[model samples]
Target: MSLADSVSVTVKHKSHAADVKPPTKTTARPALTRLERAERFWGWIMVLPLLIGLAVFYFIPFVQNIFYSFTDLDQFMNWSTFDINNYLDLFSDDDFYSAVFNTLFYVVVCVPIGLAISLLLAIGLNQNIRGKALFRTLLFLPAVTMPAAVAMVWQWLFNKDFGLINYLLHFFGVSAVGWLSDPDIVRISVSIIIIWSSLALKIIILLAGLQSIPRSIYEAADIDGISTLRRFFCLTLPMMVPTLFFVSVMSFIEVLQIFDVVFLTFDRSMVESDTMTVTYLFYKNAFYLQQKGYASAITVVLFIFTMLITLVQMAIGKRLKVA
Candidate 1:
């Protein structure tokens, strides 16, 4: 066709293309659609039974536990018999003081030592090596094992006669220790068990923390010729502080609430004091002595201890943020 005719046709086509409206931008689905709301409603409905169970089994009993601490629940059904004598008596009781001291000592000694050992394990396991999966699984076994079972096994192992530990000690020409019998050594034995049982979880947590650390940071350290100890202190520890903090708090709580291991390991038939953890004492007072009110007081004290630890952690976290 003629040049003007071709040019006119091309211009017409361009005009038509421009006139055609682009597909209207599809509107986004509304937030919380009817279907979404339905799903959420069902979710809450499914959880209703759990909420009810918690209220009935935990919340109500928790309030009553606190109330019982203030009252003489053992002596009378009436609130009129209520007094602060339970608190007064708890303070006066030598057994209570010893139990508190023993429990606090366990927590103080075990948590830091356990964390240090578990961190070393995590570092070793985190290294590029053969059979690491098997190693990880073996390390985590204790975390899944039943506490009572561990307690029983350790009790047997710690036995002065015919025990694996003592047998090993004898082989090395060391005397068999009165691990369970001696009050001085009882806390150490319990601490050992706590460390063994708690090691698995802390190792897993720290391994994850180690893995989460950016590779670039290590590369930079290498480029700067940073020493191993310097790299660890400057890079690893600081970065892993949050995880370490969490692990420390959890370890403290677990050590503080220890019951099964201490109960299983210690010989209750003994004349000498062996196992007198706060929880053990609480059980002895609550059930064996029929002083539920006094036991409740002990429980309240434990609750306070846990809350204080959490609060201190929060304060430290705030300070970290400011820094």
Candidate 2:
């Protein structure tokens, strides 16, 4: 009698659970309808503020700059003419040509060297060393520092007389060279500052990329008796290509727009054609000379140049399956 009763109870419980399951599951499921769709759309609506901000602050101004390029507009007023005079003027102006050449030169020199130094630092940091965090922090410090402050410091250091750099040269029995004053040295000095300023941040990015690589790959390489340098080239460098490409693009753009250090270090009279960047030229046109329209034109040209270079880099990056 007791066994039958227990079996009957179990069967009843199972039937009850089976009956309740479908309704419970259905009730727990989220409802889908017009209102729910509207609610779902509100998720995107939440980002509207950010979208609006970007449109207003970035897109509108950029488009306006492109428009203003053709106009002979200035802070005073628009000239009674609309033409491509600004662009034509840029071609005729020797200083403008020099700025263009100087910008290109800076990019060619700084970007590759900066990327190499950053990658090397990243590799060194990836090795298990004492006080690793401290070293990394110290390296990254300059990246976050004010550019003006760095320019001031570099200006003093690059001084021909009573400067640390020249004093160090004295130790090596080399004569003091005019690092900032001489046109030849000006471009080189500026490039050095740029490279030094960028090294820390790029190292951090590449280090992160390196850390993401699995230890199993390295272990396999070692088991095959691959040399350390060979493993780095074959395994590490290939995996880090995407990050390296990104750093290269960023460094290229940064070097192109170089102004603050160039401006602070050199007076207008002292700065030669070789050292004047497009941005510095832009400043002179926009404020000093009050040729805002021409400055706007130059800005558009530089922006287009940057966009083209970045697009080219991205295209090359996509084609690269070397990894």
Highest TM-score: which candidate?
2
For residue 5, model 2's alpha carbon misses the true position, in angstroms, by: 75
lDDT of each: 0.86, 0.88
What TM-score fits each model?
Answer: 0.84, 0.86
**Candidate 2: Cα lDDT at 59:** 97
lDDT for each residue of candidate 1 in 1-323, tens digit (9 for 90 to 100): 99999999999999999999899998997799899899999999999999999999999999999998997666444454678898899889988888888888889889999999999999999889999999999999998998778878997899988789999999889998988887678778888988898999899899999999999999999999999999989999889888898898888888888888777767675312755788988988877888778889999988998899888987897687676
In candidate 2, what residue range of length 10 has the lowest lDDT sum?
21-30
RMSD for all candidates, in order, please: 11.2, 11.2
What lDDT, from 0 to 1, does candidate 1 have? 0.86
How accurate locally is residue 216 in candidate 1, as Cα lDDT from 0 to 100?
A: 98
